[model samples]
Target: MIADIDGNASVSNATGKPLTKRGEATRTRLLEAAEVVFAEQGYHEASIVKITERAGIGLGTFYLYFDSKQSIFEALVIDLNRRVRHSMAEAMAGTSDRIAAERAGFAGFFRFTAQHPALYRVVREAEFVSPEVLKLHYTRIVEGYEAGLARAKESGDIDRRLDPEVTAWALMGMGELIGMRFLLWERDENGLPPAQLDERVFTAMTQMIDNALAPRREGNHDD
Candidate 1:
């Protein structure tokens, strides 16, 4: 399990308190250091020595907290996923409609990517290149999305013929595709004001999501 406040072993086999202040501090430092290192250099290129140096800790100290650089990377991904889920939960708590919920959810996601560009890059890379990491990061969110689809079906909000699981995954894919385009700067652009660029991107995303979920008109329900 996890450790106590003084940075000592709090658990003797099983029973113990949370991490000590020093333990927690060390943990935070490692995570911060890993985040920067992983962001600066892709996961394959990042080294334990670099991360420890950034954390200002010894190599043995790194092992005391984590097994390997891969473990730390997994921890970082899990941490980011938790933060994203928390943000989505907060946004969803106030909205009932699916479209409204998606809008708020995507807005929160957009803000997160805007704020944590490096982390976003890491997540995007993992999606295409690391199946294990992708599943680890996405399983919970996919479960929740499936639940929403079930609700939509029950309410006659979605076509009863559509598989909820497939629909949920498709929705997730759509969001990720849009996010990659917006945040990755995949297109070539020179110097521009950051604020204007952010605003333009945010507005474009809001419109994209709106159009994506717009209600089908009577005659146009040809699907």
Candidate 2:
């Protein structure tokens, strides 16, 4: 089964009918293939033929799932967004506090980004291929982040003065750029990103986050 933008179970086909287990598997294959094709070749250069070829599925089978290239592209964006957020949430699970959650969540994000560098390329191209999905991607991530930050603020784990919405965006932007600069840009002997983010970079980044979010003590005026 596939998930819609709202995280509901979705058929993910033009027919809107429930898919059998095998059908679900085929749709997943197409999406996986679409990820690589869209990443390697931008939207304009990518074609349904290319995606199907990569999937090793028949060309006619493509339309059964998606009516057009744009539809699949949009679906792929949502799919990637869901998976990445899941990675972060999974890693943050069982953490004791917001600070710990933040570190674990970011570690999860970087790990996924390292494994799927195509995430960066595909999402960036979404701005052109499908602007709405691009917004949805970022908004979905921020919604969860803002909710977490809001809870922390209420519990005195973070600065009460900080607006959760704004802070969420700021922190998300920080993570994206940091990953792009370090993990995405750096490559190993095999020309692949390191399996994990650098310890030094992660420590420095988390320190900055901690200092910014940590609660202010009484009578401490060091702004």
Candidate 3:
């Protein structure tokens, strides 16, 4: 991550500016608080005061990191987007095959979603508040996914006929909806989403993915 000396509320991706350990900690706190405030109050209702209170920081300190409500909101989205992708990438890292990688990636996604329900809310709100950032989120994920899928296709890891771009988007959409249903909407007695997807459900979803992306043979029913 880089820094913007120009004083953006959040960190920038371009410059290689480094923050002190305390500065990084403070920034993390602000983003976390913003997550809770946005999830509970929605973008329009959330205020700087509320975020600072939730973060246990002062108004002046908030300015040091972020300039306004929107800036912080955008930062929050970026933070969530980066973390979720990291989770997926890390999970997929050691997988031995394309199918395993996909399954692991989705598992990571759901895990992050369950742990951070605010992700869904903040992203949806970005459509209205910051559509560009919203696009950045999906496009960034798809770029990395397309690269991996392209490599897998070249190596016969997945169906050679599959278009990497289309497949990447389709898989992402599938994961999003499935996560929304199983990880976000499905709740326990206390009304909290499960920390992990059920084993049975996970198996069912992975089976479907395997069948969908696996290459076809002459005797296959789809043929």
Clashing pairs in 2: none
Encode model 1's per-residue lDDT on 36-118: one tens digit a residue: 89888888888999999998999988877777666677666766776777777677777867767776776676566555666
Displacement of the residue 209 alpha carbon in candidate 2, Å: 0.4
The lDDT of each candidate is 0.66, 0.89, 0.85
Q: Tell me the TM-score of each prediction against the true structure.
A: 0.74, 0.95, 0.90
Q: How many backbone clashes are present in model 3? A: 2
| Stretches of candidate 2 exceeding 4 Å from the true structure | 1-3
Model 3 ranges off by over 4 Å:
1-18, 217-221
Q: Model 1: which residue pairs collide?
A: 3-19, 4-19, 4-20, 5-20, 5-21, 6-20
For model 3 the local lDDT of residue 31 reads 89
Over 1-223, each residue of candidate 3 has an lDDT whose tens digit, in order, gives 1122223244532133456778889888988999999999999899999999999999988888777788888878878888899899999998999999999999999899999999999999999998878887888789889999999989988888899999999999998988888888898888789999888888999999898788666476565
Candidate 2, residues 117-190: lDDT per residue as tens digits?
A: 88999899988877888899999999999999999999999888899999999999999999999998898888
Q: What is the TM-score of candidate 1?
A: 0.74
